[model samples]
Every structure is written in structure tokens, then in C-alpha cells.
Target: MTVAIVGDIGGTHARFAVWRDNGLEQIEVLATADYSSPESALAAYCERAGLSLGAGSAVCLACAGPVSDGDFQFTNNHWRINRAAFCRALHIERLLLINDFAATALGVTLLEPNERLAVRAGHAQADRPVVVIGPGTGLGAANLLPKGAGEWQALPGEGGHVDLPIGSESEAELWLLLHRQFGAVQAEDVLSGAGLLALYAVVCQRNGQPAQHANAAQICAAALQGESLATNALEQFCVWLGRVAGNHALSLGARGGVYIVGGMVPKFADFFVRSGFAAAFADKGAMGDYLADVPVWLVTAPYPGLLGAGVALQQAG
Candidate 1:
């Protein structure tokens, strides 16, 4: 049995779970703002669960930012950690940090059929590249390539920072307005949780209506309740998400398929399916036919990042 500390740290929330041979155990979620550092968060979780880390217990964390040179700079949080410092703080012998999207990509390979929601039933070609992108507190993306018959390597990249695409004249107008405020617009600007709020605000402003919701959750609720403006904003988000996924698929030649995972999409799977998501994904002019055969799946796994962190630890050994 391989017992290890596995975590998924995001902008607003951090989750820790015990990784065993069967699956994730003792899963817990903590507010990121409640703790000053990852070490403190882990300590709190351990105290609650009556668990302790041994001298050389394996630890792997999936963080929502770039990790390099044994250092992690959280994209949305203020925590700054070095591998050595973290080890000393947590009293762990070995620790590994991986990009959140990379972890999601790796976890996709281990998901069961019941854990996946079929958005598009296209052909998934083996040995081809796979792309994973999702919107949570922020947008995340990664690619997976086959290493061998049962092995794969995940390539993490800052794909969310890429320029947002505009397909219609109305969208171009909105982009100009947003560009004036932010200077440069990226996909994450209007594709994440905060992005949903921004989208609703902008759309409301454009329609000469006052903003309605205070946050993304409220906006999603209103949209589901048949609020016209909120629904419009949500639809736009889905369309844009689909377009971005298609772009990633084309760029990576992700014939193995594209998987959507994060805190957002799973909340309203039916809404996403009925929205303009599929149409936008296959709407690429020249590559439309090419992408039509590439499947897109919505990951419904309960704790994918934890699973990925466990996989990381196993692979390290």
C-alpha cells in the first residue's frame, strides 16, 4: 500500500486527501484565505483527521501556478514556497510540486467511464496527444502525450494567458472595451469564475441594464433561473470555452480527445451540454471537419487533482 499526502491547491480553495491503493481517502477542503501557507493547511487537516506524516512519507501538491527550480509562485495566492523550505516546514523528506492542469491531465488517464460525462461522442485516437482545459478560479490547460503502451507524459503550459479569440463583430466590440480596461485580454479574463462575473457585468452594461449579481455563483443561479441577461452571459462563456478548447485541440493535434475539468463545468453539466459549447468547438472554418471527430469530455471525478498527485508520487518512485 502506497500512502502519501496529496493536495490540490487553487486560488480560493485547497484540498487534501490520503492516497492509498484503492483510491482517495479522507478528502477535505479548506479555504485558502484561512491559512497563511500550505504547511499550516496540511497541519490543520492532519489534526482534524488524526493523521501524521512520517519521516519520509511521499508528498505531492498540484498548485494553480507555475512551478520551477523547486520554487512555486501561486498565480492567485500570496504564498511563496521553495521545495526545501516546504520540506523543513512540513517535516517531510520528499515533496513534489506540479502545475494544477498538468495534474488534471495526468489524472484523466486514470478516470473510469462513470466519472466522465460525454459532451461529444467523437473518436478518441490512441497514441495521439490529449488536451485538458478548465475554468475554476482561473483558467488552466495542459497536454498529455503517450510515452508507451501504458505510460504518458504531461506537458504543462500557460495556455490560459493566450489571446482571446473573437469570432463576431459584437465580440470584437466587447474585446475593445475590455482591452481598454485590462490593456491585454486573455482567455482567462472571461472564461473563469471571476470571468463569468466580468462577462455578466459587461453584457449587462451593453444592454443598458444595471448589473444584477454580486458574484459568479449568483450569476450562474440567475442564469439557471431563466434570467435573460445572465443566461446570455453564461452562453457566451460556454461558446468561448468551446472555441478555446477547439483551438487547443488543433494546436496540440489532440486526437486522443480534450477533457474539461475544474470547479465550474461540473456544476451545470446539462446547461453546458445544451449551450453553444459543441457548436462553437466544431465551428472552426477550415478545421471544422477535423475537430468534429475529436471527442470532448467533461470530467466529473470527485478529486482529480488528488488522484493526479498520487500518480505523481507513484511515478516518482
Candidate 2:
């Protein structure tokens, strides 16, 4: 039987799986820090799965950051991929690479109803574009366009690097603080995992208090425990995320709805649901009504990137 390998490589973790019989098997997630390179990680996964790759086998990797010229470097990780070297080392017949968010957009199509949590109630227009945005080690964005029948196209870009939007006078003050620290503030600077911690510090600074939490997880835990500083930072995070997502929705006219998929938001799903996200999303003055009906959902499915990698492989074949 001809089999393939599919992977989703992010900044911290690299997930691998075997593609056979139209499904993924032997799925494994490895820490990127544990391996020197992606090839090493794959070899480790292959050993654990007791599989071997050869001339007829193929590989598809959904990687974070831009993919180009058969080679790419990850945005938030140190590992890099040279397509020629990777193919030669594994003896694979073919290799396909795609932006991680593009794979995410494709994966959104495969989500079951139960795998997503609705944030806003609205009707999704048939055949209209769908927006996908998420924050992990970095922020990622993509658009899914229907091509009739059941096919879709995923367009990925670095929407995360866009300038941070200030929606209030207080937000302008916080932006100035962030700008002073980072030179220029981008959405990713305040919407990602690290961004969460950074925002927490800024909140503490604004209140003239010492920041007690050291990491995003710590801050989230504190927020859940009713810590005022942490709560404020997390709430602001959700509001900013909603604003950025709304911008993307407007830019693409994504009336088909928006899917929020990422490691960060899922961590604080409960708080995010009740936070200022929905209000901020629909707060656009002239376009408030236009965005009011644009639905949004938070994806909770496991291994979506891997699933999308498999989908991309099938599409290529």
C-alpha cells in the first residue's frame, strides 16, 4: 500500500501522523526543541510508529510562517527546511509544503459541529469567503474561498504583522507603552502567547502594581481565579483579537463567517466567550451592522493542522 506522512510544525511542537486508508494513524506530537531539525523529528516519529519511507511515499508539512522556493524558515522556531535535503534524506517520492494557517483554513472545512464553540449567532452566506485567524507563538490569518461544488482555496498571509489598532483613549496609552518597548506595535505583539504576558505586564504598569504572573498560562490561571490585573489583561486581549478579526472579515468581505483557531484562545475559552470580543468585533461605526451578522466560532478540534496537511496532500495527488 502506498502511504504518506503528514505533519504540522509549529514553534513549540511538531505533530506527525501516518496517512493511510483515507485517515490519519499513529499520530504523535514531538517537541521541536528536542530535535535539531524537522528531519530528525520525523525520523523519531517514524521509529515510534514502526514505519519506513521509500520511493513511493510522499510527505506533506504544514509549517508556520511563509513557505517559498522549496525552502523555508519558521517564524518563531529555530528549525529550517530545505526541500531537496528533506526529500533526499527520507527518500520520499514527493514533498509538499504550505503555510500553517493555510492548512488551518483547509482544516476548518473538516470541523464537525461539536468541535467548534459559537461566539456569535448569525447566518453564513453560501459561497462567500471565510476568514480564519488565530494566535499561538505568533498570529496567523487566512481566507478560505469556495470554488463551487465542494472544493475550496486557502489564501494565507502575514496579517498578524499589521499595525495594532487602538479603539479607545486607554488603548492609545497602552499602545504608546508597547511602542516604547518594542519600537512598533503589531497585532502579533499583543495577540499571541507571549503577547498575553506582555499585555499583563503593561496592565500592571498602568496600575502601578508589580506583575505577579510570569507567563501566559500563569496569567490565564490568575484571571480565572479573579485576579484583577490578570483579568484586565486577558479581557483586553480578547477585545484586540476581535478587532483584528473584524478587520480581516471586512478586508475580505468574509460573509461566510470566521473561525478562530489557535492554541492561545482555547486556553481561556470561557473568559473569551463572555469578554468584550463580540462587542469589539461589531463596534465598527459605519460597518457595525455589516459585521453584526458575521458569525464567529472558536475551533477546539485536536490536530487540525495535521488533518489539513493530509487534505493538502490529497489535493496535490
Q: Which residue pairs come into collision in candidate 1?
A: none
Over the full model, what C-alpha lDDT does candidate 2 score relative to the true structure? 0.90
Q: Which stretches of candidate 2 lie over 4 Å from their true place?
A: none
lDDT of 1 by residue, 153-252 (tens): 9899999988989988878877877787677899999999999888888888888999979999998889999999999999999999998999999988
In candidate 1, what residue range of length 10 has the lowest lDDT sum?
Answer: 49-58
Estimate TM-scores for all models.
0.97, 0.98
Candidate 1 Cα RMSD after full superposition onto the native fold (Å):
1.3
lDDT score for residue 80 of model 1 = 70
Query: Which regions of candidate 1 are displaced past 4 Å?
Result: none
Candidate 2 residue 72 C-alpha distance from true site, Å:
0.9
lDDT of 2 by residue, 1-317 (tens): 44789899999999998888767888999999999999899988888888775523889899999988857999889999998899888888788999999999999888889999999889998789999999998999999999989889999899999999999999998998898889989999999999998899999999999999889999999999999999999999999999999999988999999999988888889999999999998888999899888999999998788888888988887
By lDDT, the best candidate is 2
